[model samples]
Target: MPKPEPTELSRPYWDALREGHLVFQRCSCGNAWLPARRHCPHCLKPEPRWERSSGKATLVSWVVYHTAYHPAFESRLPYNVALVQLAEGPRLLTNIVDANEALVADAPVELQIEWEGDTALARFRLAHVTV
Candidate 1:
C-alpha cells in the first residue's frame, strides 16, 4: 500500500487522525473540507481553522469497484468507495465499514478510524445510536 506523505498543510490533519480525532478546515466564510487546501474551497479565503468533527455524517453516494485501480488494492477488490457529508457540512470521499449491499442514500454514519500501515484513515459505518 502507498502510504500518505503528509505535507506541511496536511500534517496537522494527519496528526490529529493519528491521535484518534477527525478534523476539517473551517473558513471564516463557513466553508469546510478535507485533503487540506490553503484556501477555502467555497470562498477562496486563506488559512482556515481546523475543527474537530463530531464523528457523525450521512451517506451521500458510493460505488463498488470490482477491479483494483492499483496493484496494492487487488486483494480488496469489490470494496466500496463512498461520499459522506459530515454533520458540520463538509463532504469527504471515504469507505464504509460494512457490507456493500447494506449501503443506502442518506444513512447516518459515525467515524471509525482505520489504519493503512502507519497512516490513520477515516472510514465510517452505519451509526448505532441508542435511545
Candidate 2:
C-alpha cells in the first residue's frame, strides 16, 4: 500500500483521522468539504473551520475494480471505489470495505478509519454490517 504525504494544509485532516476522528472544513455559508481546501468552494471564503463528522454517510455511487492500475494494488484486486456523500454534504471518494455484493444506491454507511502502515485513512462500511 502507498503512504499518504500530507501537506501543511492537509495536515489537520490527516491528523484528525489518525486520532479516529473524521473532520471536514465548514464555511460560514453552510458548506462543508473534504481533502482540506483553504477556501469554500461555494462562497470562496478562507479559513473554514475544522468540524467533526458524525461518521454517517450515504453511498452515492461506486464501481468494482477487478484490475489494479498499479502493481502495488494487485493484491487488493476486486475492490470498490465509491463516492459517498457525508451527512454534512461533502461527497468523498473512498472504498466500501467488506462489501461482497453490489451496494445499493443511497445505502447508509458509517466511517471506519483504518491504517495503511502508519498512515490512517477514512474508509466506510454499510451501516447495517457488523464488525
TM-score of each: 0.94, 0.94
Clashes of 2: 0
lDDT of 2: 0.90
lDDT of 2 by residue, 1-131 (tens): 76878999999999999999899999989988987999999989998999999999999999999989999889988888999999998889999996649588989999999998899999999998566
In model 1, the runs with Cα more than 4 Å from the true position are: 129-131
Which portions of model 2 show Cα errors greater than 4 Å?
Answer: 129-131
Candidate 1 lDDT by residue in tens digits, 9-124 = 99998999999989999999888898789998888989899999999999999999999989998999889999999999889999999999999999999999999878999999
**Most lDDT-accurate candidate:** 1
Model 1 / residue 59 / CA error / Å: 0.5
The true-versus-predicted C-alpha distance at residue 35 of model 1, in Å, is: 2.2
